[model samples]
Target: MTQHPTKTPQFFLTSPSVCPYLPDQQERKVFTHLVGDRAPELNDLLTQGGFRRSANIAYRPACETCRACVSVRILAEEFAPSKNQKRVLKRNSDLVGTLYPAEPSSEQYDLFRDYLLARHAHGGMAEMSVLDYAMMVEDSFVDTRVIEYRRRGPDSFLTGEGEGELVAVALTDEMSDGLSMVYSFYDPKQEDRSLGTYLILDHVRRAREAGKPHVYLGYWVKGSRKMAYKIRFQPQEHLMPAGWERYQPD
Candidate 1:
């Protein structure tokens, strides 16, 4: 009989780069590769420790002087959508979300490109080619899935899928505790629908239905207006210096 030893993950630090969330600030990250059979377990552990996944890498902010990038997770079991969020849900009620294997489609790429151009035209992912997009969706080694949102067709009730044009797509990782939204993109033309808020609301419903406790919303940076949306999902816990504690804004 032969015995094998478990390998420990290796972590690396990134060089400082311009912080996208805050002006006149630099950002650094501590990251590790998430690969092999241990990927799912590793993902669960690292995510709970405040790391976020990109491709097969798990990373968390490691700023030397700033600790503003706080990790947030919604308490799905106790979440109550506010009036505006409820309106977002009602507005998107006609759409149906179907979970699919994490495989990229041309349709998804088209929507992704449109989203980048309209929303992040000068950001890092603006020049991403089709191959890059494919890698983003298909390079995962853990329990990942793609949820596509579209209009509910007549037969949607039977199949639990949607029909017509693809409205939005979410690349998600199903961890032991909750769902982690890796990335999502939608039709920029449908801005009136408030798809971004709708997406998180839908995830809250999903996490509760599946008996999951949290919906990891990644880093919520203080002073970043873009991140203000994350704080709205109340009764959430923030990963603090003392550990996960219910957030109470001062």
Candidate 2:
């Protein structure tokens, strides 16, 4: 077998642990360091192949006898928001998004804490500390950015932006093929707004406006309510044996 120099790249596997989404299934991941000149290319490929990046590592769920986690990418250029999607867009009309370097701020941390407590208090990321949040946002080799969504103020007409508290944020990775939404959080209190869906919609717009064809949305695990939402973005591509194939809702 022809071996690439990356074969020996630092590798490790997580000990069997409780799966956050599944009731009784345990989960584990085998990961490798994503560095060197090929890191960007590898990261993009990994993302398409159903892996997610954390800090400097790109890893995927390698559960025994399980293939439930599927990678999904939104075809941004071809995206046409459904009637409900349009509602989500109009719902957050008062907000403006600013793209900034992937640096964590105390304000961001506070919002993150509130989000976890309200939405995923029982999930894996609930115990993450402020420093952990910083590493999650700041530790990266490939280009990363933070989009902060706030309310519009008086100068909103000139800037079309807001000066109110940050209501939502997305940590994204800029790739050659698309913008990978690494992670996103929003004010959970505004349940009526469905801000999570709004962020995904916004990224779809940003990706299309930037001339990118796809918006990587990480993995969508079967039967996982937390991930089922990814499937709603129609005309997306799901990685399969023959490579990315279009997935249209039934």
TM-score per candidate: 0.96, 0.92
Residues 53-124, model 1: lDDT tens digits: 998888999998889999999999999999999999999999999999999999999999999999999999
The candidate maximizing TM-score is 1
Question: Model 1: which residue pairs collide?
Answer: none
lDDT of 2 by residue, 1-250 (tens): 1123564466679899888777888888989877666778888877877788887778988888677778889999999999999999999888898899989999999999999999889878999999899989987777889999999788978975669889999999998888999989989888999899999999999999989999998888889988989998987999887999999677
Candidate 2 clashes between residue pairs 3 or more apart in a chain or in different chains = 151-162, 152-162
**Candidate 1, lDDT over the whole model:** 0.92
Candidate 1 ranges beyond 4 A from true positions: 1-6
The predictions' CA RMSDs to the true structure, in order, are 3.3, 3.8
> By summed lDDT, which 10 consecutive residues of candidate 2 come out lowest?
1-10
Query: Over 4 Å off in model 2, which ranges?
Result: 1-8
